[model samples]
Target: MARELRGHDLQCAIAQAAAVIGDWWSLLIVREVTRGHHRFEELLAELGISRKVLAERLRHLTDHQVLERRPYQTGPERHEYVLTGTGRALAPVLISMQDWADRWLLADGSLTGTAEPDSAEAARVHALRGTPVPAPLLLPATLPPGDGRAPGAASRPLDVVADARATVLFAYPATGVPAPLPPSWGSLPGAVGCTLENRLFRDAEPSLTAEGVAVHGVSTQRPDEQETFAAGEGLTFPLLSDMDAQFAAALRLPTFRAGQTLRLKRLILVVDASRVIRDVIYPVLDIPAAVEEAGRMAMKVVEGP
Candidate 1:
């Protein structure tokens, strides 16, 4: 049996807000739509909401004028639920929810400029805080490419010097093909935001390369995983795989063990023609701004001191 939305008989503005979008399912539906998950199937797959509950919430939202039903297909008559202007105004409400939850629900340093975590992310964050690189200041030792083919390699063990005037080596933990996420992954702190950060850098590569600053995405994921991600994501920059931990050992890079594998903490290195570290951006908190800042720093190194 479908449960009816409870009626609220209050005159306060807050009550009115609750009347329209009080339920958890409604808010989640809106959040998914805002992220471009417009179709019914997309929302169902992403949210894991039951069909009956989803249909009920959609009807409620449409009735309240929070969302409008628009036809997308003609022959069989398919429709999509999109936010009305009134619904669009509720975005801040969701953002505020994330801010509040991150502050109170997560541990110190757990949010990492993103949302709160579940068990997997909690473990990752805990591991990250516990491990510290012995040497923070020094150039990482040069290491050979795990395979002959990297993201943008002309050849194996990509010659950092021959690649560009300077290279922005953006090191990340790992990348993979989308799969069934672990049960607690949705609650993982900064997990979604990390992917957003990678996309931001990938989009900025053309400009970075034009300015004589080559970009290379580095991760502990194997060569094949990096290749699949780079190709699928339309990334033009090379992606270096340090699966064996040889590169991390060479530089004593900060790392955390997720399972038996040690993953690189998020860090960006500006390496000049001499293979010397020119600048380092550690613990990247902001995505777009980080790439912009890296671009500014890269331009400086390319122009010479």
Candidate 2:
């Protein structure tokens, strides 16, 4: 029988491998990076790790050449760390960790959103090591332009992006004056977007079909450029880009009041084939409106036209 790596042993292959990545945090850092987390603030926000620990982990990973630092901009000149080839090799390791944890961590850590599938189904998520995962199946469903003669008919769908994939969609809405939702609300949309997108991806393959892709536009180069992009760094998916207003106008979403700024209304689209949006979800304060609609829309999209 093959023995396990142990203390004071340097000859075993496992021992050698352990020397490089025996630390738990190292693996986590790898996981986050693989999930498209690139900036310092983004990582801290996701894992809630202390600054000292985060700094140390990043330094260690970089020192070992698991990540490569690149210059994304020159104005304020911040640095982003991308995965090195060695780091890319951890995909299997992280996949296995998530798979194992799904079985063991469910009772202890269900982490808010959708429930994990039963063990039988989840095991299938593992055997796919042989097949390439498909992209989210996005359909070009756009809302029909309301007649200019209408009074209060809801316009169309708002912005959509894959959070981790699109805030983090490639990351929402309201009326008059224009207010960014509270911190709590602002915070959740990103995670929820990430979760929903991931849920769909997990359920099937690429082909991330969504209402529309607006958040993708907002993530380009931080309209509010600052010392930290926390949720504004690089996005996992490509947003609609610089044209978020187009969605807001089409949807006739209400105006929000963030002090005095006029922000785009939060709208969720349900599109049909040929890019004709079928349903529209106005700005929601919580998850229910979006959730129920998204659930229905996903079924429709997955089932076809």
- Report RMSD (Å) for each prediction in the order shown: 19.1, 20.0
Kindly give the stretch of ten consecutive residues in candidate 2 with the minimal lDDT sum: 219-228
Q: Write the residue-wise lDDT of candidate 2 on 50-136 in tens digits.
A: 989988888878877888888888999988777787876665455444434543553343221122334332333223222211122
Q: What's the distance in Å from true for residue 23, model 2?
A: 1.7
Residue-level lDDT of model 1, residues 105-196, one tens digit each, is: 54353433232234333333334322222222122222223544454544235432335788787777665453233344445443335466
* Superposition error at 111 for model 1 (Å): 12
Clashing pairs in 1: 117-187, 118-187, 152-238
Per-candidate total of colliding backbone pairs: 3, 47
Q: Cα lDDT for residue 145, model 1?
A: 37
Tell me model 2's lDDT, rounded to 2 decimals: 0.42
- TM-scores for the candidates: 0.48, 0.38
TM-score of 2: 0.38
lDDT of each: 0.61, 0.42
Model 1 stretches with alpha carbons more than 4 Å out: 1-155, 160-162, 178-192
